[model samples]
Target: MMTAVAQDRLGGPDVLYLTRRERPAPGFGEVLVRVRAASVNPIDAKTRESGAFLGDPPFVLGWDVSGVVEATGPGVRLFRPGDEVYGMPLFPDEAGAYAEYVVAPARHLAPKPAGLTHVEAAALPLAALTARQALVDAARVRPGDRVLVHGAAGGVGHLAVQLAKALGAHVIGTARSAQHPALRDLGADELLDFTEVDVHGAVRDADVVLDTLGGPDAFRALDTLKDGGTLVSLPSPEDDGVIPTAAARGIRAGFMLVQPDPVGLHHLTELVDAGEVRPVVAAGFRLEEVALAHRFAEAGGVLGKTVLTVD
Candidate 1:
């Protein structure tokens, strides 16, 4: 049996409890992983507490996974037993990577970058995919572009800033003044202290704006965008909203939600392998401490990704 955290009812972290479950076996074209680590994200917090996406309790709460493949199902050709791999498993669904073993699509899994350890690799999947999708697939951030990233020191923001730079864009980031140095270290050309300065004034001439805020007021921030620039929102935006104004200004906007994509994970592997990107782990909790991890994550803000170490 594998140990995992599950909820009998949706509420708070207290509803989560450790329990034993039968070890999972890989399905066709999948790999059964012996999990080493998993990372916590706001999605898990929202889903677990509200049961919004989960639909019910007694469901697992994890997506990011880093582990060694212990077995493979028929038709799986990408990995063999004992191969170390990492991936963001099926999202808004059963990933169950919080347990000792998880079954993931073979194509979704990638070789953990040689430079990253299991714990570090565990922190990258969901956050990196979010940033990568926003910048590359949605905004199409390109060379010589001036990009602005809101909440830039948080889990996904930190990586987004670096990714913008790696894509040859000049990146500006917004965070508390205390986090400016950290953002700068991640290659942010400028930092906006959201507490003191107007976020719009801090960033002008933005060729691309990666907005992580899903709050109702975030649409107002778009007024600062230049004509023909792009805005990539990480949240589900309202219909007939940001788009009309963008079209009027000859600007483009993308309401992008991240998904598990094998191609993207493979791309991330290259960036990590070359030291062009890095995963910052803020804190790690053990499997039994999953509740504490959830509590810490919901406390408002964290400098980097909060992770749950399984083994």
Candidate 2:
């Protein structure tokens, strides 16, 4: 048996509670991870509150996981029992990472960066992968390219600023003035206080814009991009006319959903090990304090990621 956070019905953070269930075992090409830590993300809270993506009750929230491999099923060769590993497995599905144990497909995970602790590693997967996919895969950011990241101090945005800089792009970030020093230290070439300045006028000719804030903010980001620039919107599934508007402006605009990618995880590991990228942990909570963690994450104004430790 294993202790996991489960909700009988979706409502709010109050719905999350600890319970015991049969310990899961790995199937073919899978690994059973003894979860040491998990991170709370906006998606987790959104899913818990409105069933976003996970359209039902009675589910465990969390995809980011950092731990040791407890067992491996047949055909699994990438990792052995006792190996430290981390990944966002079965994203948009139930990997049940907010538990004592989780079973994940072998290809969905990679070696945990040796330089990072379990808590820091746990903070990387979903948020880092989202930033990596958006900047590297979707935007195809190149050296010398002008990249702008919205919500620069937030989870994915903070990572995006670093990743874009690592990719050789001239990174710009949007956040309140208080976060400017941190964002600049993260390699942002320029910082915009979104509260005080009009983003569209303050910055223009961006080669790529990573929009963590959806809706009108996303539409405004289009104006900041150059004629052939790309805008990758992370939130809001409804197109809501931004696609056609972008087309008319000769810009590329679309939404991107993060997926399980072992390759991306490996790349992140390389960056972390090389000292080029690091996850900023805003707070830590015990596994049983998941409700509090959810509340903290939903409250916003976090500098980086919130983590849940399982001991």
Q: Name the top TM-score candidate.
A: 2
Residue 22 lDDT in candidate 1: 91
- Candidate 1 structure, TM-score to reference: 0.96
lDDT tens digits, residue span 1-311, model 1: 88988888888888889999899888899899999999998888887877756788779989999999999999998899999999998886779878999998898889998888899999999999999988999888889999988889888899998899999998888899888877788899988888898787556678888888855434655775788988888756644677887788888875787889888999999998878899999899998999899888878556788899987
lDDT of 2 at 287: 97
Candidate 2 per-residue lDDT, tens place, 1-311, comes to 99999998989899999999999989999999999999999989889988888889888889999999999999999999999999999999888899999999999999999989999999999999999999999999999999999999999999999999999999999999998888899999999888899987889899999999898888888889999889999987626788888888788899999999989999999999988899999999999999889888888776899999999
What are the Cα lDDT values of the candidates?
0.86, 0.93
Residue ranges of candidate 2 with Cα displaced over 4 Å: none
- lDDT for predicted candidate 1 compared with the true structure: 0.86
Q: For candidate 2, list the clashing residue pairs, or say none.
A: none
Q: What is candidate 2's TM-score against the reference?
A: 0.98
